[model samples]
Target chain A: MAGGYVGKILKVDLTTKNVSTEPIDEGVAKKYLGGKGYAVYLLYQYIKEYELKGLSPKDIDPLGPENVLIFATGPGTGVPRFPSPGRYHVMALKAPLTGSIGSGNAGGKWGTSLKNSGFDGIVLEGVSDTPVYLAIVDGKAEIRDAGDLWGRNIFDTTRVLTSVVGGKNTSVTCIGPAGENLVPMAVIMNDEHRAAGRAGLGAIMGSKKLKAIVVSGDQKVSVANPEEFKDVADRCLDALKKNPVTGEGLPTYGTAVLVNIINNVGALPYKNWQTGVNPDAESISGETLSEKYLIRKNMCWACTIGCGRVTNVKSGPFQILASEGPEYESIWALGSSTGVKDLDAVVKANHYCDELGLDTISSGSTIAAAMELNEKGYIPEEDLQGLDLKFGNASAMVEAVWRTAYKVGFGKYLALGSKKLCESYGHAELSMSVKGLEMPAYDPRAVKGIGLNYATSNRGGCHVTGYTIAPEVAGIPEKLDPLATEGKALWVKIFQDFTSTVNSTINCLFDTFALGAKDYGELLSAVTGWDISEDEILKIGERIYNLERVIINRLGFDGKDDTLPTRLLKEPMPEGPAKGQVADLEKMKEEYYKLRGWVNGIPTPGKLRELEIEV
Target chain B: MVMPIVNVSAKILLFATLRDKYGVRELEVKCDGTVRNLLENAAKTLNKGFLARIYDISRNKVREDIIFTINGRNIKDIKGEIGIKDGDRVAIFPPLAGG
Candidate 1:
């Protein structure tokens, strides 16, 4: 067994109530590493099997029993002193919202506990006639009836399951009312509030009738070259501690630190991206959150940079005794984008999303789109059922969150996400989405590279896949002209490919702000006893990215789907420092396609062969 | 003929650690029409340590880690030659980002 790998995979077929185990393939581990990379390979193999049976990848229903869901971690995960190794990646054959290859990564104790419980990953297949949950304790796995646990919110579900499983390191990952109701924007939450929060994979679990997965154990991840691993880890840790981003800024303000910086740069999308600046930004910024609501800082297991905010609203209608975050994206999604400046209401709404097991980005972005639709008078007033679905109506915004979770009233449309919701209301152009998934807080109109990244991201309008903001806005590694398109395609491609590799390592993306590709190569080589190089690391990442693209292609997406919303391309930003600026996507995109060796989003045969991807 | 060095006031916006350290979000200062002049004047008004914190005394230039922008344009984009005008928003942030 290689260092950091648990050597076995747990497979459960809910339909037949069968539990099986498989040994980790050494060749696959070598090529794909683990986590997202390994899982993508597995999903592609499953798609090939479907093809053999004469079923097209497009025929696979996202919410159907045919879709496969995977929970995977990398060779770096769970190892002691591995920087932020407390995260895991989840992938499904398709996402209910995007219909592209479903992917989400989350941080907390769950991933680490699973590895400690003697498994490298878990593969969930088929559907159950009754509600069930998987429990893995020590080295044994079992499927137990979850009849009593269904329909509970995420908090209660996690609490009940943890007590039932009773172990020193037990952790639970599960869906809630939103998932049980099969809300298309539902998320799978673990460790109380940490979420695999995009692409609605929770609904996939809901469709499978699986409620939760409980894991607990005391197994320590073995390190192959302890002396060299320690030396490399110590050097990386020093770098992380020395870097201002990973060391001080994040520790002081949490992720919401970007709220003000991005706003100042005139890239903070507001009121459904009608503009790029929010005048009331300070009230919801990281500095304000630290000043007013914070109880203390929180962190994932084995994480050194404690960026998580433990907070409370103290005394208000939106008051809560305890909560975790309305991180930068959450604050923007629920607060600025919807024009709700009330931090209390934003916190309350964010908490509701956590409890109800919802993706904060999609949930809030969908509501923002609806707000536009309502303001334009396109939505029938009767459909609202007296709810004021207007921008800046903080109270109504808070009410909309729970309604969407339960799929009640107007939330029925909101549950379909922004793309479908806007299209259903005769105003598809108002949706501020790309490839059916809602984009994050960054306005591509203000930052040219992020716009290109949004259009070309494998999992739809995602920032984390390739956060060009680091270079374009926050100026990590280096600074670039936010409005300039020159050389942005190459930057976006490198960031995207590098991010793919980082996700497979299954650690916090924040680590990359301090550690570079060479550091990762050294760390992995030391841990796995493989002489990995920086070039090889990037190559593996490119292979994983291309394979994911292949899966999406089979699912009926191509170059045409690689696009931004019409508003970003045509409707120039109206105000702020970036006034009159629009995302010049075409120039950058043409160069991007050429650099990628892709023709209209599909990878060429030569490119695939170069990456060692089996066609 | 020589042009008079007229001092113009610019709005200074600070964020993250800079804000916490200085205990102010925005300020105004007069400078002789350049980003460097504006920063230098603002540093005097902010505190003695402000200049020391953002400038590399040995290199005799603004520290590489400091993110200085004029009206949302990074100073690096302009090769540090961007001239500041009256009421221009000059925001200074330390190395910081989160997704």
Candidate 2:
């Protein structure tokens, strides 16, 4: 409690309706830090304390009450790099969709506000007897009935809650009807557009009958040494302002700047890579999005990089008049992957998914698979309620979004994710995914280290797990050949550990991309009073990563489970700069195993000791 | 005997700090070899330590924290070996902060 954490972790047991808050020792906080770091520690604590046992016919679902939803924030959050402060990534029960621990970062202010409310994290346990939302402001907290708002989508629910509670500044993280209905791809939405949108953690939240987490904190966050932190932070911010991406390009175009670049690099996986790169990429370019549909831009509290876009569609055949993002990931999934290059169409699809609180990345990916199936005549138009579902059909793209969000007809299967949909279509290999989570925009074969990250991530295929992308694809700090398989395994491993550590600290990743790891240690030291070396910071990452690995492996993902979707390995890039190339997974995996110090892909004893991660 | 290799004209978009860091965005530079040559030439103009921040560090892992997107692919993908072509947009980004 005397260290990085706010000193306490809150646990809500819905089965017994007992609310208890425990103080994590200073020792654990110092070792684990907060946000994602504490999340892993909390996962171990929750699992060790409450393990689900043998099931029964009456068991209903096997994941059971022992599976807790741990939402955590870090100490350096809200102090610098500003924005709701702190990271709010999730660690959920192994979802049926992907069968891995789905933890994703959600922008907006919930994580920062949660910490501001006097607790480092919130662990929702058991299942509630009825529908409710946990409402917390400053240090005051309560679980209020959400019966009236039960069927409401994200937009209406947030509006109602905002009025009922009397504030615009109050940040609300809520699930949509999809989550309320336990759709596997449902996502938790916050600040209207930002979602902790992977692995169906939202479905877990919905199953608990917890609709939203409303938080507003006016209190200032306390750092171990504010003056020292302020100096470093101020210098960092000034330097950031002087740089280009964080300083100019990102602020100017947001992440959409990648729309043109990735498109040109032939990195964008279009229409399931039935075609590798779109010829009419300009239609979906950031310049086009900004010129035609760009409306207003917004930033998360304290975030200096305003990479978030809010836009409006003045006229379209779509119902989505307004929406939040077509963040680089969503743009890829809903746009090129579906063969719909029209930016307006992408925005409309994004709006639909967000309003329903569905995960845009997964939702878009699964629908694209459906469209691919439809194009191949695997399913008919009647299967889509008369919607002419075909790749490149904007109308069908729009329809698929509504159908999946509302779970109408074929949309029901699509909601389960592309992995299952592909299997149903008799082509499970077409899904372009590793774990149940849909792949981000970057093509793995084109970026070697990203492929390694996707294969080894405890959550199955995930970019955030390692983001070897920084080195593998986007030469942010260094250059590497996208076509090369050498040295990538080790690259993915350290990054996974480092990123997990960053997530634990609860800071926005956009910060670390521009700065050094020592600066991170410094910022962290000023918050917790703990002297941590870069090696120690990296070790903390290994600790959380292994902790998550233990959870997912315990839930079924193990050495055998860490694999790329067959599509990535067997299918060569049909066209573009990466044409004729497929991920050389055999060499890559072997190299990765060696770098990880894992014996035949199983974490070695020395490696376990190095991370201090308990098996 | 020495023969001349074909030269390609490239356009790069430099903004704000970099505009000041590098005096010109549209310059006709002839490259007979690799992008590394271009980067080295640009490095000569920048303040000491600035170029090192964007390339692999002394301790190595790559200090090129700056985004040097080739066609939009982070040069990390193609390496510095990507041959330049006429009309290619080779944009280099420094650090940034407005959110």
Candidate 3:
């Protein structure tokens, strides 16, 4: 037990209705830090233990009782002094979609509440015979029947749980109908809208018959040296305020500001990756949103840089009450990718996704793939059940969101996600995914470094895994030629390693725009009483990354799996600044593997030994 | 012997905070000199507060945090006394970021 961490890990077995607590080893904490780092290490340990008992690693079902769902927090989480301490939790499991290392990071009061309620992390194993919800109140845990809450949308579930559990202070994270139906795009949403939205961890929750987790407590998180921690925290805060991206750009316009910028560079993915530019990009741009619909800005707990947007289309065909996002990714996924320029329709779709507990990126991208298929005559009008499934068909897009959540009609196929849906129709190439998970907003061909990051990402097709866009587009730290392949492998390695550490800290990734690796090291050192240096902290990030790589490799992935979609490699950008350019994935993959000390995509024995990872 | 020189017109696009403050997404700025001169002209047009955010008063250099791009290329890549041509799209952002 040490300062910063609550020092207790809770393990709940729903099948046995048993709960146990254990002291997290200090050695393990120092090595993996926490959040994604701890989750990955613990998951690897679990898988290894299982394999020792004769179950093959590849045979472990992602949705079976064997799969472990982890909700983890880091030492820096819930610390008031830390910049963006609001980001305090990460959800990790064997993703049903990618079937590899699946993880998602989120920000809100939930993580802080969980930590304050007296646990650093909670691990759920085995399946419950009946639907249940876990409630942690003042350091004690209980499993309650969730028969009444099972099929409700996230918003309704949160409201009902808050009333039944306690009061306004109770933070509830729950899955909606999408999760209950085991839709692969399901997201676990908390605070009504914020979600651990990728990898279908929500579906895992569904598979376990678990509904929601509500936590509320008043315990204070202590630091080893409060004075030292405050000083470093202040410096970090000052840096954030002084940085234009964090202090001004983000807080003011939120993430949607990138629409025009990305489109201007011709990096915005449109119409299922057929092109890089969107003619109606400006119509749904952040500027337009701010001018027309933004009601106010929002933030997570302990966050000074408020980048969250609360928007409302007060009166229109797409009108609805004020709601939380339609962030840049959602806008791109539902708008540009689907070739629908109606901002209100996109916002409406975003609202539906949030309410239904779906990952907007996967859901929207899935619809886009279906649109392309329908247009190509792969899907007949009868297949859509009289619904005109065409790109830019706003009505169809809105309806698809609702249907996909409920797995109704053609939506049943959409529920399988783009990769599965496309494969079923014998057009997997049109899916625009890697490792079965749909791609995010960034166009790989336009941004070569990001393309490499996408292909080799442990979680599959994720931008946050290694956001090369900072250097490639925003020029944070330093500007790199987006088209250049030389030295990109080295950059991707650095970014990926650094991001692993950031995710482990459970802090908002936006903090990196202002703070450097040393700043994070100083914050952690003050909180944990460890004299950690910048390079040492970065090494921990590298170790965590390599550990995840080992887990995926052990599960049967190799260099062949580390690849972009065929369209990204074979098809050139048809127009705009990126016209005629394609991702040089092979070249970057070779250099990336070498830099990672990996043979093919698997970590070499020496590399494993160097990182102190046991095979 | 002296004739007045005509200024070149370039479209200046501001994003995020700059856009919010300027009250317009894009504007046409006329400058007959280097990119620095165009920025200075924009500073006068948008107000000095905007310029103070992008330029360092003490160093007399473009603030490192200001991401200045000309026709989708970073100004740093273009090299030397960056000149702006008529109808060229110059995008100036205040360290903008998103996923």
Candidate 4:
């Protein structure tokens, strides 16, 4: 294989109970990049087989033994070029939540150790009769019994696995109590902090009766040419370390720093987007959190810029003694979305979500939707089971987090995600989400690009793919009216394709936030010794986008399906400089489709050929 | 009266848990003039650390996870420099918040 590669793929067949090794060829790595690319490639190849069979009895049951889950690491992973290589993903059958191709990323030393353990990827198939965890040590795979670790939460599971593996060098990725219980919104955790926290893939794992995958090894991820790789990668890494966002901003405050900025700009979705700003936002802001509870800051491996927060609210009224965050999205979703901006309450919510192994964003947004319905005279107060589920009540908010995890009281409805929860209440318009996933902190009425990303994201509503507002709002590249949608479609397309490329490489998306594709490509070329131009790299991104879209299409989603919530389309901003603004989604969507070279909603044969993707 | 076109620069260091944010552990900037100079002129469209060069990675540029210290005092404790002098590290980095 070419540069920055581990050069092998491990395919384990659970049905026949066989494990096979596949060599990673340079021809594919040079074009597809890594991780997500390989996942797409493998998925496409597998789907092609199903197509040839033409919907046979074996093909219909995706949950059956034939379905596969790929845990993939890319070329740049565990390499010295970029500090953030935590983009490894688990991609497989339709999730119970969105039923889209389940793709979620988590960061830790797990991917690195897996590479060191003599494999670039792991493809698990069939269903094992016994519950077991995969332990890979230097190319050796053992299906170890996880009988005692089966029922534990993420925290306890991590510790128990830690004790079982017996080393800090051991990196663990596991599902928790929520996943084991098969909650539709359950998540998978890595490094005790990082998570594959979307689309209830954990439920899929739980369905398969898998508990944990602990990896540790000393194998180094190899690069094409060491001298050139080190020079360019070192420069780029140094540049990222030197970047204010990567270097200082994120590390010091974590994503929670968005509390003040988004709140100040009236972009924070408050009370479930019914309001623009949170009145009690400051209570959960980085300023207040740092003043009261910040214990320290932390970062992922090879990351020069640390944005993860470590906090302790020892004497707060909340049940949590101390913990990391209430990050920005969670603060918005759990804090302002629920109308409970209490820092202590936010901390408790974060800790419980971590323990339960659930995505706080989806969980919080779901709670907010429920509260909105409750206050709107829809769900009876008794449905809340005597809990006064009002906006801005920290006590009730904290309880909601636990209840949802435990699936108690009013939480069963919330476990269904925002789309289903509101639909059940016959107010589907009230849920401010695309697909089934809820929107993050950015309100499209204020930041148009963020809206575009959320609406068009393959993973439903998401921001990690395109954070264009950093230039548009934060004035990083340039300042534009947050309320305006000028040239937003083109900008969104650039960010999308580029982000898709980076994420596929199995590297951190944040590393590219500071620089453009050219600089990132330089590092890739240096590390891989591949003649990948910026245009080629971007095209790879387009290929991944099309691949994901094709999967969605195969699962039955299309341009007509590319839709925003009725509220975001019809509602005007209630307050702030953008009082009358709403997302110009129709224009952005049309432009996006044109840029992607799709015919109507379907991928054009020409564009597919141009990317060398044969269907 | 003439405005000074002094070179402004700042570099951040990683300590405690803040070290994770940086892909590396340091950065340098060639900001134009005064404190207001780069804030008003540099590539602000870039991320803060890229644009501000030595600006600490604090959320909102004023949040708690990161802060810049000058002359043994926190930048928040002082003028915080409207602009930096050439070769000034500005000592931007993650704050000391852990036990």
Candidate 5:
């Protein structure tokens, strides 16, 4: 039990109503680090054990009682000194959406609270007989009845849980009705607005009949070598404050700042990826949001860069009381992707998604796909239940948010996500997704490196998994031609491996723009007293990434699955700076496979041996 | 004999806080020089503090915080000495970060 971790993992089996605690092996901790990495390792172990018992991968159901959910925190998490220390934890599970490993990280007080409650992680197994919420306080755990809180939205559920739990310091992470209803697009909301918002992790919670987890404690998280840790932590904080992206840009405009920039560059995927640019994109840009809607700025717990937006819309058709964000992804998903130019409507939809416990990206993308279907006469007017689910129909878009959350009429199909919705119509190619998860805002046709990243990402079409956009679009470390596939494979592999480490450390990936791998290594070493080198830290990242890839491979995904939709590959971007461009995936995927020591997107045996992964 | 100087009309585009401060999305500046010279000319329209924000006053180079892209390519890759031709688009943005 060193400085960085509580050194204990809480295991709860709801089917048997049995709970246990196990000591974290120092060797495993050193190799995998924590957060997503730890979760992936644990999942691999679980699956291997199950296989030994004669259970096949095909027999495993993502939403079934056998699926495991891990909420993990890194060594630097909850440490006030680390840069962007507000990032508390990441949740990992076999996603109901992609049916592979699904991981989502959230920044809020909940993670710090979990650490203070004296556990580095929590493993939830089996299915509860009825709706219940887990309450963990100062190392003690309880599976309490949540029958009354079962059907409530995230806002109401949090309120009820806070009052019922009766501790002012208590923080809650819970699912809303969308999760309870088993919507594959459901998200887990923590502290009301922050979400573990991708890959249908919330549906897994719902399937277990788990409503929420409330935690609070007064225990102190102490770092090893306090003096050295303080020095390193201070340097990190100063670097974050001085860095332009973290200090000035993020605080000033929030992430929506990218809307105008991306749009100007012809990379803001619009109207279901039909085009890469939207003329009215400025209507939902960060500038517009800050000018007309931003009430104030908010920050995650212990974060210096307050990039979070607190917005309100008053005296309009899109009037909302107040909400935390309609971040860049949400804006692009609900606004540009659907061709709804009204900022108010997008904001209202964002609020609805947060309250309803839905991943706005998937939900909005699903709706946008349906809108295209409706526009093309594939979905009849009667099929939409008299609602005009047409592109740019702001009113209908807002209504669709509620109906989708409730899974009513056509909303039920929308709740199934864009991939399923499109497949249901016999046009699966129309769904802009990689492996079953809906794609985010950035058009792959415009950014070749990002296209490769999307195709190769282990968790479906996630952007943050690699984020080649930093070099491709923003010129963070250096700028690369967005249209060039040359050397992009090398960059993607480097970024993916590095990102895996960052995600596992459970720190915000935004910190990477400011701090280098050495900075992260220093922080971890100072906190954990592990004496880890930067090279070793990067190797840990590679190991974690390879482990996840192997798990997905075992789940039947291969090079064929590591691909973009036909639209990105075959259809050209009709207008904008990237006109006539398509993702040159074949060229890049080959380089990527070679560089990662992967054959046909599966990690090679030699690569696994090099990473020291047994399976 | 002096060589004939061909002036280039470079469109300058600003984003985010830069846009809010500059009060304009884009402006056209005609100059017969390199990208650095064009930036210097554009700086004439901005206050000294704002100018300093986009350039390293000590290093006499484009500030790392300011991303300057000429023709959709980062000037850092092309370098400031890269010649600018007429009708070239130069985009200036503060460090923009988001998912």
Candidate 6:
């Protein structure tokens, strides 16, 4: 086994109550690395197992017992002094909402604790007959009854589990009422506020009658060459500390700092992307949040760049004594998307998302779609139950959050996610989602590369998958015209492939602001004792991306599904710096398919073989 | 026959750490229609640190990391001989990113 691996995977069968361990395959580790990449490999293997039992990929329901869910860590994850090593990736065979590949990544202490508990990952198969939770301590594991803990919100569930599983390095990753209710946009929250916050995978956990997973241990993650690892890690840390984005801008105002910068570029989606500019953007800017609400900055385990906001809304209708965030995505989704410029309300809505275990992006976008539906008279007034459901109604937006979590009255509709909610109301185009997952803050209509990325992302409508915004908007590494179509296809493909590797390594994407593929190659080689070159790192990423694309293809998604919303493709941005600009998707998609050696979005068999993928 | 030099007034927008450091969101400055002139003119009322960060006195050029956009278009796109017109909005930000 390579260094930085626990060399074991804990396999739990909830239906049969069978607990066992599986050895990590070194060859698999070489190709996939771990986290999203390896978890997808495990998911694919499970899919093949199911196929032998007469279950087809398209027939596997996301909420069914057969849906494989895995929590995985990478070689970089939990390695001491690895820059932003706190992140982990979770995967499911299918996502309830997207019906595509299920995936999400998060940062907190839970991933580190899981690594310390003597496992590189956990494979959950079969559904429990009753509500239960998993407990792993010092290399031992068991399933415990969680009937009493099933109905609790994330905070209460986490608090109770932490005390019950008391010991050094204990942490809990669990579902809240939203997941328990089987809401499609439910999030799996860990370490209180950090979330694997997309694809409704939490509902997969909920469907399995699992409430939480508590991990506790003091195992040290060992590296093959400690001296060389330390040397590379120290240099990477210095780069991160010196880089303005990671060292200063992020630490000072958190991710919310992008509010002004994005809005300035006119790519900040506003009011359900009807316009690129928000007239009252500054009122909810990061500057205002830091000035009025921030208590202090927080960090994930071993994170040098503490972008997490520890905030408080002391006295307001939306008063919350303590909260973790409304990161840039959350702020835009909950703030401007719904046309709510009130910072307090955004903060309050954000708090509800964390406590209730709801994905703020999908939740806010759903509400924004609902608001549009209501204003257009597509939704009858009586269905609202007097909730108003209007754009810019801060109080109503806040009310919508808990309602969605608990699936109360109108929230039942809201909980359906924007894709379903808008479709049910005869306005599917209003969803602002691609492949059933809502996009984040960046307006794809204004930025061409992000648009192409969103249309083709393995996971629907994700910005982090490619994060072309780095070059298109922030001028990182190099600057590109956000509105330009030329060369963006290459940029999107490279960013997507590179991001796949990073997600596999499973560190914070912010590290890329300072470090690049070369830096990651050095770090991986030193820790894993592999002669990983920069080119090889990218090859690994391309393999993972192509493999994910193949998995989604088996689920019945095709080139037809790879597209931006019609509004983005047809409607030009009405006002702002990017006025009259529309996403020229087809031009870029053509080039992208050629670059990936894909035919109409499906990878060619030759391409798969070249990447050493057998499918 | 020499043409009369007309001063162009532009709105200088600051973001991220630059906004926090400068203590103002936007500044109205009159310059001779050049980005360098606009920054130099804005530097008169602003503190020395502001000028030092965005411009190098020795090199007499905008700092490499400073992202300067005139009317929402990057200065790099327009290349050399870029001009800042009257009523233009010039956004200045230190290199920063988050998703």
Compute the lDDT of residue A556 as modeled in candidate 3: 77
List candidate 1 segments past 4 Å from native.
B1-6, B57-60
Scored against the true structure, residue A215 in model 6 reaches a CA lDDT of 95
TM-score per candidate, in order? 0.98, 0.87, 0.96, 0.85, 0.96, 0.98
CAPRI-wise, candidate 3 is medium
For model 4, report DockQ. 0.04
Highest lDDT against the true fold, candidate: 6
Task: TM-score winner between 1 and 5, please give it.
Answer: 1
The TM-score of predicted model 5 comes to: 0.96
Separate DockQ for every predicted complex: 0.77, 0.22, 0.66, 0.04, 0.58, 0.74
The worst-scoring run of ten residues by lDDT in candidate 1 chain A lies at: A473-482
Best-to-worst lDDT order:
6, 1, 3, 5, 4, 2
Error of 5 at A209 (Å): 0.5
Q: What residue runs in model 6 are displaced by over 4 Å at the alpha carbon? A: B1-6, B57-60
* Higher-scoring candidate on TM-score, 2 or 3: 3
Show the lowest summed lDDT stretch of 10 residues, model 5 chain A.
A84-93
Clashing pairs in 3: none
Per residue, candidate 6 scores C-alpha lDDT tens digits across A452-518 of 9999998899999899999998888898988889999999999999999999997999999999999
Error of 1 at B87 (Å): 1.1
Clashing pairs in 1: none
Off by over 4 Å in 4: A56-66, A319-321, B1-99
lDDT of 3 by residue, B1-99 (tens): 964254798998887767767776788888875666677778877887877887776887678878777887677656567778888988887778977
lDDT of 3 at A495: 94
lDDT of 2 at A234: 79
Candidate 5 lDDT over B1-78, as tens digits, reads 974364878898888888888787888887775655676677777655666678776787788767777765566656
lDDT by residue (A1-615, candidate 4, tens digit) is 676787888887765667788888777776677787778788777777777878532234435565667888887788864658755878875666776667787776677767777788888877777677877777777777888888788888887877777633578889887777677678888877778877787777776777888877777777777887777767777777777677766776777766755655667788888867777766777756766888888777766767777877777477555566767787778888888867788888888898888888888888888888888998876678877778878888888877777778887767778888888889988887777777777888777877878877777777876777665555555544566676887788787788778877777776765666777677788777877778888888888888777777777667765777877788888776467777778887888888888765678888888878878
- Tell me the lDDT of model 3 at A65: 88
lDDT of each: 0.91, 0.72, 0.87, 0.72, 0.87, 0.91
lDDT of 4 by residue, B42-68 (tens): 334334554344433343353433444
lDDT of 2 by residue, A356-445 (tens): 988877888888888888778787566667777777888778778878877888778787688888887788777877766787777776
